[model samples]
Target: MKAIQIATYNKNIIRALLGLKTVEKSAGSPGDDEVLVKMHAAPCNPSDIAFIQGTYNIVKSLPAVPGFEGAGTVVETGKNTGHLLGKKVSAFVQRDTDGTWAEFFVVHRDDLIVLKDEMDPDQAACFTVNPFTAYGLMEIALLRESKAVVQNAAGGQVAAFVRLMAAENGMEVINIVRKKESVDVLRQAGARHVLYENDEDFEQQLRGLCAELQATTAFDAVGGPLAGTIFNSLVPDAELVIYGGLSGKPVENLDVMGPIFQNKIISGFNLIDWKNELDAEDFEKISGFLQDKFIGGTYKTKIQGSTTLDKIVKGLRGYIANMSAGKILIRP
Candidate 1:
């Protein structure tokens, strides 16, 4: 099978070599509890870039295929996993392995989440990461009775998911975006409040927005100087969850006095960590939320582009350029 590999990892000039014609390498026949899937589509996420650069938490061995989450059809299954054969499923696999970027991959039957036939393949490809992260952040930080929450990079797919989820829960969202145009994008997607990060009075405006919304929690994706600004705008005893560092800079120092004196809480989240900590019952609960949203037509994926496996490098470059509003997919 032809696939893409991280040909070189130069911090200054990272390169991916596409059209690597090669035979499929099988790890092993599916265990009794595992299923083999023929991958249909997988998204190129920021984490994929981090993996290639070796800056991500999970380091990849050189010449590895890289992708985090994806959806596919079951081709075969172990005896105990036989019920899953021919079903559509999504998975989160270990990095550097033959990930979703390949023609085929295997996952534990328990780890695979079944998807409905009505769901789009591209949307299903993205089901595991962004949506689940948004859902978990809200579940962990926002109490049911909380009025509102704030988030950075509000225009992103995950943030958009958060905004809609909040609205459905009867909670307001104060979504902050670096670009003015994103304000419109998020507002159309159900954000109750929007702030422009580039505004000269961004700090003042953010505080005013939080005050008006009475926001008690903030989800920060852009972790650099922007994180400090987000920290400053929280209500007393509010919680802030930092999950991404798209800014490529260290998170700014917060005024320690505010958190300590105001009794605010600061923490971080990594979806992989959260998933690892959850038992089967918890996974079912979270998966149920996503499933319900899909049935209700509340969870929609905006596909930026789709291409064949041979064009993987081009897809990665497109994502790196930030040229897509939604996800860039590779169909195998």
Candidate 2:
């Protein structure tokens, strides 16, 4: 099989670490509840980089395929999966299985999200990670009855959906970005409260806005001190969900001590872990909800560029340099 495999982990240049090789492997046959999919497209995500660099929560062995999600057609299926044989589907690849970056993939039928025939392959290909994470975390915030939510790295791909959630529910968003230009980007997109971290009054503004809205939950992708800063801004008995460590720093070392005895709770939220908790029907329902948002141009994804199989190294490097540019898709 032709696939981009991670040969080893490079701590310094994690994004640019990969190799294109014609590995001798194949999905021989599906079990009674499995299906074989001929992959159409896959997106290059930060999680893929983390997994290949051996920095993700779950580590893959060396010489393994590295994509996490993609969309494709069910080429063949086991006896129980016969009804799904010709359907278009999106799936998440568990670390142990050969990932979705390849030409073909096989996974349990229950993991598949059957896509509507009119759906674009590109949208479905990149569906699992950002869309699911955004919706799942926002749902948590809504469940907690938060009046507003604050997020670090507000210009991120997944954070866009969070912005949409705020707009739809009339919930205020304390969006913090690093660059001045990003404020305009979100502001033009209907975001009323965008701030820059480099501002002299950044922390003071965050503390004020959070207090005004009485925000009880925060969705954090940028870890480190930023997480602690947001933690301190929330009201008492607030909850913080740290889902990504884009800062490449540890949560324990942050200076803020709000979570110590202020009734602030800090926890982690992984999309894959949340997916694992759902039954097949519930997973499909959530997928359908997101699909409706995408198809309606509400929760849309921006594609910076599409890369072929051999150009994955260049793609990863470009994405790492400018994550806010957009998602880079692998159209093999």
Candidate 3:
């Protein structure tokens, strides 16, 4: 088997190297509760970079194989889990152990989600984090039909998912991006309104759009000064859900009057916390919803780039660039 490992921890310092010879090791030789999978594709998400930089909530020991979600085919299974053999599946794994970056990995049979045959491996690899995060945000916020929502980093995969899901639910989406070129990209992806953060009249335009669209809920991933701006532009009694801090900085302070006088609320969300509360049945239900969306062409994953295990450095660097409007995949 082959895998990629971080030689060191530094965001500007690209430390991943490829073609490292390794042996796949599993616990208890695949017990009845486990299955061995030959990983086909895995997406490189922002969390993966944070893991390497030791900034993520879940830190990994050095020389770690770092990937969170991936899709693969079950090649071997314990007697009690034999039913899953030969099935294509996707999963989220523990952080410290050998992850989807390797050619082979093992996950509990219960954790191995059977994906629909029509779902492509690349799409399945990119599925869990962005889609589930978008769903959880909407669920926690108690969004209503016909109400409008706002999202920052609208060019990101998760933001794209939120826009599409909101549209399907009969809600309007006001997407905020930093580049003018992203306007068309997001609009084509179903964003009802697109605003550029770097525009000279950004705040004024956002207020006008919010007033015109009646947008009250804001989903902000780039939490910094941008978050404070988004919070201020909300209608009275609206909510702001902060999910990611891509700015690598803290959210700016806002005047106390907004929340006290306007009756607005601010909340933070973590996908792992939400997943811990769901049982297998609930998980399957969410998976079914995602599967249906995929089948109906309501959900789509853009591929920024794809590479084999040997080209991991290039892949990692590409992800670090943070300009691609899609997920990067690695085949191991």
Candidate 4:
């Protein structure tokens, strides 16, 4: 089987791309609780980029396959996972073994989400990460009974799904984006409240909107001063949920008095952590709900383009250049 192999980790993205090579690899068999999936389509997500650069939370050894999630048909099932045979599934792998970037991937049965017959393969390719991240963030907001929420990196897919889920639950979203065009794009997508972070009066607008909407929950993906701004601007007792570090900086300019005097709180969100807290029954219930939304076309990941395994280096560069444009799929 052919797989995209990275022999070394490079913080410089260009060097990382230069290091990617497609090589013939021996396909490994599954164990008792595992299944072998014939890869259909995998996506280049931000997490994959970070993983390749050795900056992500979970890093495998050198010469590892980089994909974290994908969708495919289970061709070979282990003794304990026979029920998944011949099923179309969306799966994610966080193990040190080879990943979904190859023609064949072996993953534990617990990591698989059985896809609906109506779900598109391209969408399923991106199924595990962003959607679940958004779901977990919204669960925090809903648990707090928040009427509205604010999120930076609102142009990303997870933020897009958050907006849709908020609307469905009768909550509002105050979206913050860096570019003026994204403000327009989100508005055209029916986002009621969008803010351009570079605007001169951006802080003023965010503060006023937070008060008006009584938004106490903030999802912060880009750290740095922006996280502080959102943290300080929210109503008292608000919760700031930090998920991603896209800005590559620490949180700054935070008002110490808010946490000291007000009941404000800062927390971190991890998709795996959230998923672990749920039992099998609850996990299945939530997964079914989310999949139904996709089947109904209520949730969709924008797809910019696709490439074969041989052309992944070039395709991934395109994706890194314009991630907000959409995702780039790798078909094996």
Q: What TM-score would every model get versus the actual structure?
A: 0.90, 0.93, 0.90, 0.98
Query: What C-alpha lDDT do the candidate models reach, one value each?
Result: 0.77, 0.82, 0.78, 0.93
Best model number under lDDT: 4
For residues 88-197, write the lDDT of model 3, one tens digit per residue: 99988764566678887777765667989888777888777888999998775454333888899888888877877776677788889977899887777556688989
RMSD of each candidate relative to the true structure: 2.5, 2.1, 2.7, 1.0
Candidate 1 clash pair list: none
In candidate 1, where is summed lDDT lowest over 10 consecutive residues?
Answer: 13-22
Sort by lDDT, best first: 4, 2, 3, 1
Q: How do the residues 255-321 of candidate 1 rate in per-residue lDDT, one tens digit apiece?
A: 7876789988889999878888899888888887787777677788777888777766666667666
lDDT of 2 by residue, 1-332 (tens): 56777677656664436444446577557779989888899987888877766777767676777788899999989989999999999888774777888878887876778898777889899887788898889888889888899988888888888888777888888899988999998898777888898899888998899889888899888887788778877888899999999889876434345767678898899887898888878887888888888888777788888887777778767887888888888867
- For candidate 2, the TM-score is 0.93
Candidate 3 local lDDT, residue 181? 91
Colliding pairs, model 2: none
Error of 1 at 73 (Å): 1.1
TM-score of 3: 0.90
